[model samples]
Target: MSIWWSLHLRREAASVPLARRLLLGTMETAGVDPDVSYDLSVALSEACANAVEHGGDLHSGGASQAYRVTAYLDGEKCRIEVADSGPGFPAPGPGSAVRRGAVPGAAVPAVTAESGRGLCLIEQLADHVQVSNRPGHGVVVCFDKILKWREGALLRVS
Candidate 1:
């Protein structure tokens, strides 16, 4: 069986939890393993939070902008994507840590830093992560995880 959903949400703090809850509920209903669900939820939250915080037009005031979150569960993996309308990431340089669809060897934010840790966390939690920019459009954070099902999952894969 396969399951998928998408949500377009305002870039607000409250929307973060709402998205997380929806993903968690979906995972629960599909009988995904609790730990796997938790990891994905957290990753989702981080991505949502990033979008809410940075996915906006600074000159126009970002609060009024919106972002999108999409989730897909098929075969043995689950994929989630968060796309925001804020200014996309700056063009990467030769030594830049971020690439087209992955952030291999990305640096972790300093302990005292209040931000910049979400991407690393997402990369760590999800089996594969892609952080890309749409130039004058926005940024998209996409990640995928291998799913594990409960013994009697409602949508168990054979």
Candidate 2:
């Protein structure tokens, strides 16, 4: 069986934990290995935290700006995607704090003296990570992790 869930959250600090808790609970109930669950949870928190901190023009709409988190589980793999309606990352350059995650083949920048390390951390934790941005819209961070279930039986999705 496959399980999937999505959340539309206000770009607030509290929403980060709420998303983390739900992901943790879902993974736990699905029998995902504790270590793997913890890793993913931390990664998810980082992703959500990035969203909350830089996901959008939080002060522009006065409450309408938001981000989205989606997750999917099937068999031995779980994938999560975090997207926000922010003004995408700043252009990449010599002194730019943003990055080249826009193109699918864009190499994830090496950890340098830059301020943003969220993407680097996500890449290290998840089995695979992909980030893309929509011009004049926002950015999306998608990642997946390998899962080891406690039981070999078919897992059901509630």
> Which candidate has the top score in TM-score?
1
Q: What tens-digit string does per-residue lDDT give for candidate 2 at 1-158?
A: 88899999999899999999999999888888788888898999998998898877777984337889999988779999999878776655665344444243334555574645677778888998888877567888899998877664347333
- List CA RMSD, all candidates: 3.1, 3.7
Clashing residue pairs in candidate 1 (N, C-alpha, C atoms within 3 angstroms):
none
Error of model 2, residue 93, in angstroms: 2.7
Ten residues in sequence with the least summed lDDT for candidate 1: 99-108
Q: Give the distance in Å from residue 20's predicted Cα in candidate 2 to where it truly belongs.
A: 0.5
Q: What lDDT, from 0 to 1, does candidate 2 have?
A: 0.80
lDDT of 1 by residue, 30-138 (tens): 9999999999999999999988888876458653388999999998899999999887766645654542236444444557988887887888899998877676778
TM-score of each: 0.86, 0.83
Record all residue pairs in model 2 with backbone atoms less than 3 Å apart, i.e. clashing: none
How many backbone clashes does every candidate have? 0, 0
The candidate scoring highest on lDDT is 1
